[model samples]
Target: MVRKANEDSLRAQAPVFLVADGMGGHARGDAASQTVVRVFEEHIESGAPSTPERILDAIHSSNDAVRDLSTAGDVGTAVSGTTLAGIAFVDAGADSGCQWMVFNVGDSRVYSWEGDRLHQVTVDHSAVQEMVDAGLLDPQHAESHPERNVITRAIGADEYVDADVWLLPAAKHQAFLICSDGLTKELDDDQIARLLASHTGEDGPSTADVLVEAALGNGGHDNVSVVVVRAMIS
Candidate 1:
């Protein structure tokens, strides 16, 4: 475990779990990620209801903050950007259980695990991902593609950022994972599913540790962060 500051930021408060992977190449990267997390922390701590609009507002504010930081003379970076992926709770419907509001910008991801399968909830805004979606590149080949790291969308990278959003039923025994590219870069979907299945009934922190360790074991070339949220049966 290195003692250096991490550019990746995570928020794991119940009903709101997220990961931000910074992309400015040094301290600027740290600033980008920290700015986003700080805003989320404040939003969560404010005791505000987790409404879809409120969450989107917080994300917009984070984008402004990151862009502000990039332009600030002190940060020394002309442009700082980051990938954000997260899940928050919102009303499903009257008398219905709450739903997971999943969103993403750039390559970070949100995964839903249920009954021995893992499904990706948010699409990656990266070049490789686009190729895969367009059927020009095979999923297996995309992993080793040279342009795999190039993301088409990110907060602070542009004036207006559009995040892909989804509202899903938060069923009992279901687990959701929000993570940066670090973990996925090291391990594929199959590996992630197996590892997650291994810790189905364990605590969040424990599952996180195992996932991080697995990434580091396979050459942790980038900063990695993960947040696991589970819906339990009472």
Candidate 2:
């Protein structure tokens, strides 16, 4: 409830489900994240599965667009950056069949949810995450660490983007959760799982809506963005 502006943006329609949490405070974050959505919308056509190359191209193009939003000050350049996480269905090849491409940059996340279980598919590109990986800090304490918000990488923070990606076979049943750090900071994995596992009927509020509400209720210290995608391949 403390934010002056919502710096989070998302594109949750079919074919592309992504959440981008913009950096650079209220002044520039909203534009940075929205730029990502707009660029992707332009690059990837609607109502069809895209190729891996197309998705990758869109990401790189998004980085360039976000970078263009930056401004140079007398002291230094004020860089615009955002955390991006998304899932898309891609045509692998004649032999490889189709697959789900999950990609992430910075601390936003993509999770695979199946059988009422939650699994993190993308690793964070943040200072605390590196500390946790190097055994310098406990995973449990990483979130509350003073440097938890210091991201090591972002879409436009550097000239070259290093996105973490994973490919999963398109199966008969699949569910995914894409969210910004706002939700995770207020709600842990257990809370998120319980909410996602709860059977919200067609008439009820969506799981994504419920999760965002839960975060707002908890503290709402930041902008929250959530996208829940369920695919049935037959």
Top-TM-score structure, candidate number: 2
What are the lDDT scores of the predictions, listed in order?
0.81, 0.89
Candidate 2 lDDT, tens digit per residue, 20-125?
9997442377888999999999999988888888999999999999888876641123578888999999998899778999999989999999957999999999
* Candidate 2 accuracy as lDDT: 0.89
- Candidate 1 accuracy as TM-score: 0.88
Question: In the order shown, what is each candidate's alpha-carbon RMSD?
Answer: 3.0, 1.5
| Model 1 C-alpha lDDT per residue in residues 22-103, reported as the tens digit of each score | 8735347787888888898877644322777778888888888888866445443357888899988776557765777898
* TM per prediction: 0.88, 0.96
* Residue 137, model 2, lDDT: 100
**What is candidate 1's CA lDDT for residue 90?**
71
